[model samples]
Target chain A: MSTDRLRDVLRNSTEHVDMVELTDAALKQSRQITVRRATVGATLAVVLLAGGVFGAANFWPKTPGDGVNVADSGSPSASAPVEPGPSTAEGGGEVTVPPRIDGAFLYVTENNGLISWKPGSSPKTLIADHKGGEDMIFETANVSPDGRSVAYNTTSGKLRLRDLATGKARDLMDVYEGNFCGTPAWTPDGRILITPNTEGKSGLFNPVTNKYTELSFTVNGCQPRVVKQGGVLMVYFIDGSVSHLRGIELESGKVVVDVPNTAGSRRATDMSAAMVTADGKVRFTMRTTTLNGTLGDGLRGFGGDSLFELRDGKLVDLDFDDRTMGAAYQGGDGLMVLRQKIDGKYEVSIWDMHQGGGFDTEDEPASLKDALPLGYTY
Target chain B: MPDIAAEFTEFARTHTPSLLRAAFLITGDQHLAEDLVQTALARTHRAWRRIEEGNAPAYTRKIMYHQQISWWRRRKVNEQLSETIADTPSRGDSAEDVALQLTVRKALLQLSKTQRAVVILRFFEDRDVAETAEILGCAQGTVKTHTFRALGHLRKALPELADAMKGNV
Candidate 1:
């Protein structure tokens, strides 16, 4: 596909597929066991059996290195299938880049407490730990979009809004098993936090009055991803360089964005961020050898691929360099540019938006504001 | 065992899509798909303990698939246009892609329920044979057979998509 063509397709490929009727039916199917005093014990016993699985794995579908097997149900790749390989479950990701280096990475605690690394000149000081051993991580701990105010999940599994200001915490919902790690999200209003599985169906829990308003839908869950465009909660996963963008509104739990990979007849769902031009061209950030060396080694053959379906009658490939892109999110504004070192010093360059996007030797950001070349931070 | 409302809310927030995806794939109609996903999710919510204990996506998918297959048992399931994506106009590099997707979807609807399940799981979910088998609770060879036949049926249904397979990544 041509570059312009890919951008056009990505820009316009929108189809809303609502499955709410299924929600109603699914809700009817669930037999809600009321958690009263006598049954709470039995309920806990049940939760211990189920919820305990969550504790067993903090992040499933993490990555190759993150050393933890939340579940072994994942079938080995036919490309390479093994029931269980060595537990190469290291931290599991190439997130060793910047933004992360300076930021106090947000992680969920077992009992829902947000830990922050307040900036200090000394060796990374742990300035703020909510000291929340009382609640489960799923309920209490939530990080803000701007990365402030850590909400508290309780031991009994309730979501509490904790004000970073005066150190006061209040119960947002007493009836919820709301947990942050469980992908709890705050609505755009922040007045109500959205959760699923209430009213014998999926519903929203109000923080102010501690009540849950039953939504007509009866399903639970979304991956809890956010889009910069509409501060609403949604899900977007990239496959190779092309991204499969799906936006969901937490309000009615509707999927607003469902752009099928119409660019050619391809769908490589192995998505990662490379540099993208503001125009919506997605590129690759890392350079990796194929599992079978399909593309061979080091530059050449039939490599670069960027597929996009335009609204017009044509599908095109966006132009890009593949020498620099491999498989990691470089950096970007509209174009995902990255800072790579040249001759012992770092320089900012345009990253390839191809399937295995590469780095562009040309195109320098105007110097004065572009000290980024010297490695300000990735 | 947690507060019913709270447990329900949390559950709803996360698992709804899995249900819908399974349903939509099974019954080509978006409305019916929504019903299937909702019905399966609600039932799962009822037995939250068992649902929670067992694998979630699989449990929900099983419920949804079975519900959809037995649609004749009760026609309470609505088959109509839904309000969710009503305004979403299709914009692809080519109108052909949208046409292709719709065509593929229609073709999928023509297959047997299990055959449809095999295709959706294998290609859409990108699962290998064993995982698709596990999700379907069938023997690995059954999954392979289903997938092979499903592909053949798809190729027969949409020769254009069949021709494009060589370019698939």
Candidate 2:
């Protein structure tokens, strides 16, 4: 049977959810007004910080009395220029993006402990304490592709980069880690760390040179969907309508292809985009849109976003309730989820792609162990 | 307060079905699913301060997962298991219930709780190992093991699924 047949069987099962009932439940607990208030409030707070708190938020000492000496470090920038990674990371000196994501997932204990899920049948092992203080309000945490490195920030702004491979750590100060970030991505070259800001900017921090460089802004207010395209760090954006894709150069702020916006919802064709990895040829794009919020923007309330992927010239389109945030695809390899269906009233649901576009099964396993040897134990 | 009430009410409305489904999977009782939803909400309400805006879905899901696990553990020690599904259609008689769904659910129950959790997290939730690991509170390896074992159990229970899962795997 064709692959579509199996997917159909999965989606068409009689025991599926009742969509109406689900929507009823979601709307029951949700409020349109309060969410707007909170959102507006938060945005206002950000605005305040950007204006008056700038000197304090961006370039000030932690304590009120302790003055910041911009030149105390006596360096052009707090971070030095990270020499371009060797030709390649493994041996060539430059860091190479891994074709696939492989690593163990570690969890911090409820209070202050760190637990690791290693390979094999063994239970989780406690790795360390938060050293920061139990007041550790669950800051951001990230793991490297090989699972040998993990970095996180504490309730305090102190940044901690742990070498899982060596059990050592290098601390970076004044990080201001927010809830969104875990750690910087380790490029294939492994020499520089890459981070994208919601405001359409990318940051490269070179630990070796202690220098930091900000890449030209590409996409903002959304996760700059990252994928390894053509051995280069590529991020793609599918416009609001899923039409028009542009590849933006992070370093030089170049738009490779200038894709125009889709004709709007009135048009039958919706534009979406995503990344595919079979061979090494993909482009990093920073897409732009042209539509404005007229009345539909404020009155219709929250906007929506489609999580799409472009693979083999195919656009896998998915939808999200939160239009501001982008979908995250890990490891730049193997079976990137193209689109997910959202029931009315907003529930995140990724359909069974193999089963002809339906929700994922409740009984299916969580890992890809059936296909590849896995590194995570949980 | 009105907005909070509205938001809470909305959140309860939309996610209640899935939450009920999840609660039902763990509790094996409809009454308990209702109670589980209520219990989870009380905690969710308390967490509203921290979850006011950002990633509310993720925050709520984490709460639901923890609440289910807690509900499972805190209940009275000795529990009774129901052998038959309360509502099931006869096999040859396809009019009443979905034979496939019932069969899958039955087979799913055969595995241990964690295995079921892994299966649901991996497939149903469509989360990567890191995300799944976060939800299950286990290592990525455990997620993999549970997944493989769950699949193996499913196949042994229903070899017919092999045809459907073939290319996708």
Winner by lDDT: 2
lDDT of each: 0.39, 0.40
Considering chain A alone, what is the TM-score of candidate 2? 0.41
Docking quality level of the chain pair in candidate 1: incorrect
Using TM-score as the measure, the top candidate is: 2
Per-model clash counts, in order, read 112, 70
Cα distance off (Å), candidate 1, residue B148: 0.9
Tens digits of per-residue lDDT for model 2, B1-169: 4576667667767777666666555544455555556555654654466465755556556545544443123231114334434443334435433555556666656666566566555555557777877765556887777777777787787666765444222
DockQ of each: 0.10, 0.05
Residue A117 displacement in candidate 1 (angstroms): 59
DockQ of 1: 0.10
